[model samples]
Target: MPKVRVHNVTISLDGFAAGPNQRLDAPFGDGVGWGDDLHSWFMSATKDAAAGRTGTDVEYFVRGDRNIGATIMGRNMFGPQRGAWEDESWQGWWGDNPPYHHDVFVHTHHLRPALEMNGGTTFHFTDEPLETVLRRAFDAADGKDVRIGGGAAVIRQYLRAGLIDELHLAIAPILIGRGERVLDNLGEGIDGYRVSELVSSPNVTHATLVRR
Candidate 1:
């Protein structure tokens, strides 16, 4: 069976997965700023690679591309755009060739036509129920793995429904006083997972949780 997983998602020491006061100026919020400190671990991965730095950090970061045939993400992760499509001109945060080289399903309340990008990445937007979108994503995966490409809210939904198979988080040592917390509404008795592994680096602590 294919496993649904999350990889390298950063959460602050204060329990906020992403910072508050989200806006166009600060997508991850001013306190966070996409890649200042909280997400610098991830932001540095590719840059470090280009600069000829290869180590555990590079390996862990690049590992996200492995065995992924399909992915599901919330609209927020897609871009800063919200609500109905006032304009369909926005493609996404990524350029023509996104890192995702497979089918990517984006959850949205508003309908938009399927977008085909370069490098085999195609974005499919949907307003369907969670189960419906997940089932469709699993089917599209074709026995391969499906990754929950997230914003905190999306991950919360799957976590609450007990639909995720594994989750890997890179806990940043920094603190974001306010923002959306991933584990906020996880509810009690939702603890069927065990820590699969823990890897520590100077910048972050990586923890893997796998369903028992």
Candidate 2:
């Protein structure tokens, strides 16, 4: 069975995953950028390649090309804003060659044609239910795990639905006082999740969670 996992997601100490006014210029919000944090995390995660210290972080961040077959992201995560895309010309914020080199699915109410970008990345827009999108992503992954590349809301949905098998959260040291809160509305009983591992790096704290 293919497991659904969320990895490399950086959240602020204030529990905000992203800033409120997210736009093309301010993807992660004003002054709330994770640029340095992300760079540091990626560097550390990839550092052990020479030492053969393969771990979960290395698998998801450094060696993602090996394990990741497909990715699923919310509309906001796919782009800066929401609603029907005004311009079909807007590819994404990641330029002609975005990061993920595998199949990617974007959840949206409005449908758009599949976008083929540089490299092997292809963005598929689907308005179907979450389950449908998950199924498609899993099938596309070819038995490999499907990664939930998110903007918080998407992760919350999957978490509430109990569809996610594993979660790796990179807690950054900074605090965004008034941004999008990731765990705001999480109801009680969500405590079924238990922390399986904790690692502290210079830039962020990595926490791994699994359902109890």
Candidate 3:
């Protein structure tokens, strides 16, 4: 079966995925103490491998892209904009060719025409409910898995719905005092899920939560 999976999601020691006050300038957040330290490991992975960077961080980061046929992300994760998208010029932080070479769905209240980019990436903006989007993603994925690329709120929704099959969280070393929390107020929604694996890299600790 095709699984709904989340991977390489980095969170601070304080359990915040991103700091408050997100804007165009600050992708993660604005004026956070730790800044982008929570994602340092991820940044390293994007660099040339000749940099001598290796270990669990690189291994797990690379694993997130494998066998992912479709991707779903919140509008915030897709871009820094909020509310109505006045400017359609923003094609996401990733350049002309995004890393996701498959169909990518952006969950938002305001929908827009599908934007095709260089490479095989196509951004489909939708206002549909989570279930509907997941259905479409599954159809687009064919037999492959669908990845949930999140910014905390989106991941929390899937967790509340008990729809996520696997979640891989990277706990960074630093702690931001305030920001968005991914695993907050889950209640019984996460009762069926448990940490199946745990490993610590030099920069961050990895925890894999699998549903029972």
Query: For every model shown, what is its TM-score relative to the native structure?
Result: 0.93, 0.87, 0.94
C-alpha lDDT of candidate 3 relative to the true structure: 0.89
Question: Which ranges in model 3 have alpha carbons more than 4 Å from their true place?
Answer: 32-35, 48-53
Better of 1 and 2 by TM-score: 1
lDDT of 3 by residue, 1-212 (tens): 99999998988888988888988877778655332677878877656244767677788887898899999999999998889889799899999999899999999998888999999999999988899999999999999999999979999999999999999999988878888999999989999899999999888999999998
lDDT per residue as tens, model 1, 68-140: 8899999988888778888988888899999898889999998899999999999999989888988998888
Specify the highest-TM-score model's number: 3
Error of 3 at 121 (Å): 0.7
Select the stronger candidate by lDDT from 1 and 3: 3
Residue lDDT tens for model 2, 72-136: 99888888757777888888878999988889999888889999999999999998888999999
Order the candidate numbers by lDDT, best to worst.
Answer: 3, 1, 2
Question: Model 2 RMSD to the real structure?
Answer: 2.8
| Cα displacement (Å) at residue 40, model 1 | 1.5
Each model's total of backbone clashes: 0, 0, 0
- 2 or 3: which has the higher lDDT? 3
For all candidates in order, the CA lDDT equals 0.85, 0.79, 0.89
